[model samples]
Target: MTVSPAPREHDVLTDLLTQVGYRNEKAFAELYRRTSARLFGLCMRMMGDPDDAEETLQECFVVVWHRAPLFDPRLAGAMTWLMAIARNKAIDRLRQRPRTQGARDIDWDALPDTSPGPAEDGENDLAYRRLSDCLGALENRQRYCVRDAFFSGLTYVELAERMQVPLGTMKSWIRRALQQLRACMTP
Candidate 1:
């Protein structure tokens, strides 16, 4: 299960977001620092390409900076508001892409066997469950960074930017998380 932030954390984000509505650059920076990782994860999932995700994240923040005043705390939390913007931005980017870019001739009948045998299916299920439990053992931010880097295929530099951490810090987090996962799964 994912952990939700404490009320105090929510209040701080809310405060920063409110300040951002008033054109406070410092507040915006803090807000970005606190939220960018998760938002970038969402963008990566939606955009399916690191460059597109990065561009979408940038566009989302631009919209957030301009439309912060439109946020209604009664309706949603600050993160929710930001996520909506990121999601919309990702969708817009998807819509703007050339449809023909992904089009290709396919010989469907010549494709290799894609379905796993019973033994393989069982093994895959066990591995997935183990991986899920191991990932759950990680710190929330570290888990997010690992997922974004490995599952979304984002590079270290992209992960660092999304997480708003130094590249070294991002590398350390991923390394430690992987070590922990390995340890957990070894037995």
Candidate 2:
């Protein structure tokens, strides 16, 4: 059996990001070329509408252009950091729209899958199974809080109030649940 080598910390993408920090137009263009489709797709899934997704995607790139100098490779990969920025932007946009009192709940099935992973189909299935197992290991309340807060786009305050717990306790439940998930999922 052949085991793959552990992933490296640095990559060409981060190297290009360093160049972008110096206001290198070429590097920025290259970075966009390499990453735009995936991030745009992420925006699509998170926003659940193409028009809004496109606008959010544009906003994300503007952020990249201005914040390139602040990119730190030690905490996360360049692409990972960019992806988080796009996600947070989408979430912020989601939270900005007015909620209807009698509106129906969000249809999770309609959302596209934004997760990235191995190129192989088998590996993708394995990773998902592992993730499901890790999620299943959590207490019911913790699982609900984590899933609801992320997919339902509910604020922690709302979740806490719904569950009849203090805000800090709600945060702690999610945080510890996340820690358990990380431990279970990590090799």
The TM-score measured for candidate 1 stands at 0.51
- The regions of model 2 sitting more than 4 angstroms off are 1-10, 101-136, 139-141, 157-172, 181-187
Clashing pairs in 1: none
lDDT of 2 by residue, 1-187 (tens): 9998854323667877888999999989987877778788777766778998899989998998899899988877776688788988887888887764211244444555544431123234555579878988899889878876764467888788778999999999999999999999899
How much does each candidate deviate from the true structure in C-alpha RMSD? 18.3, 5.8
Q: Choose the strongest candidate by TM-score.
A: 2
What C-alpha lDDT do the candidate models reach, one value each? Answer: 0.74, 0.76
Model 2: lDDT of residue 61? 86
Q: Model 1 over residues 20-71: C-alpha lDDT tens digits? A: 9999999999888877877887787667679988998999999999999888
